[model samples]
Target: MTVGEVMSKDPVSIREDDYMTHARQVIRDNFLRVLPVVDEGNRVLGVLSDQDVLNIRSSKSNVTVRGYIRETPLITPDMDLLRAARELLDAKQHHAPVVSSSLDRSIVGILSDVDLLRHIQPTKRSPASVEEIMTAKVETAYPDDSISRIWDNMLHWDYTGIPVVSHKKEPMGIVTRIDIIKAGYARIGTANMHGRSSGGSMRVEKVMSTPLYSVAPESSISEAIGEILRNDIGRISVTDGGRLVGIADRHDLLRACLEGTGL
Candidate 1:
């Protein structure tokens, strides 16, 4: 499939002149994590994401919205979906602006990781087992670990989530960036009202997502992809029965596809 097939046409966008507050409101109202910036002629200029907005807020900068504008990764409408998806994953970008090949580089649509996964789902061929694609070096966390420490680990590793494991090496649960953010709010609220540090003494068990989504090592690659897509997650832990073994991420699937197609 080509990018044009899966991209959202006429995506929502903002002008450089728009206020930061307006951009934040647009994201909230639309439930969007990224927004494109365009010129008056509807040509692609830049893009903005939740992370960029958060960084700006944290800096406490007095700069205008123009200063927050970001240069976005560009993809042609005719590009192969798989290739486009791989580029986005490699860049760690959630969205890319689809532009016309013509002189103007006119904004045509937007391609997101979610859209690429949807396209790959039905065409996926089952491999013999998850062991064929799973990466054995998996990052993990302990249940007793504090939220502050967990956040530091996540940031250091650039991980979206980490599996919580017991002393015996059995998976207990999973803790994600979203979970930590929620916990941060809870921590601040408690600390301000109760004069205590929520993160200083609290444990990962109190905030981690339980009933972790797991896949058996012997499962087919197609089946594993389906599971990851179903969960709307970036990675999945591979296990043998109940023992942690490896992991399968979006890049693994892309690499498999590229090798299979000799791309």
Candidate 2:
């Protein structure tokens, strides 16, 4: 199959002249890691990813979207879908725009790792357990930890969310960037910048999403993939007897698809 077959058509785009803050808000609200940057005529300029926004915040820059544009490998609709997934993986990005042409810059659609997951066809080479693709180096936060600690971890590590655990390291909930941003908006929190408490009212437990979606370490990739799609979540924890062991997200699924392994 080709990229156009599974690509998200008519993707949301932003102008080059738009503000970085606006791009951040757009990403936060849309739950996207990357946004296609286009000209007034819908010509592709480049892409602004979550990394770009994070880098801007870290540097305390005033750069606009235009300044933040990073060169992206051109993706045309006719390319083999697997190749497209590989390109995205090599770029260390979760998605990319499908354009009419590299020189022309008209984006026809977008392809994400999640889109690639839908294309995965199980093969004999596929592994039977989720362990192969799961990320074992998890950065967890405690429920009692201050919200500022969670914010620092996310900022420095680019964690989409951190599993909330107890002193015994048993999973309790999950704290995400969205939750922190919402708290910041409500409390007018300056803790993210100042590295202080959000007036001591906010805690990791307060913002964490409880009753998390999870899977067992020995679960099949097919089963994990099904859960991910069904729940529409970016990631799911891999537990062994109810303790967090690893995480499998869109990237893991993409790896399985491309390798035709770890089903």
Q: Best lDDT goes to which candidate?
A: 2
Top-TM-score candidate index: 2
lDDT against the true structure, each candidate: 0.72, 0.78
Q: What is the lDDT of candidate 1?
A: 0.72
Provide the TM-score for each candidate, comma-separated.
0.75, 0.86
lDDT of 2 at 209: 84
Tens-place lDDT per residue, model 2, 147-200, is 765676776787778888899988887887776666553122343434545556
List model 1 lDDT by residue over 33-126, tens digit each: 5788887888888888755553333213344467777766668888988778767866667788899974667899999876777676423443
Error of 1 at 128 (Å): 4.6
Candidate 1 colliding pairs: none
User: In model 2, which residue pairs have backbone atoms overlapping below 3 Å?
Assistant: 44-105, 126-261, 127-262, 127-263, 221-263
Each candidate structure's count of clashing pairs: 0, 5
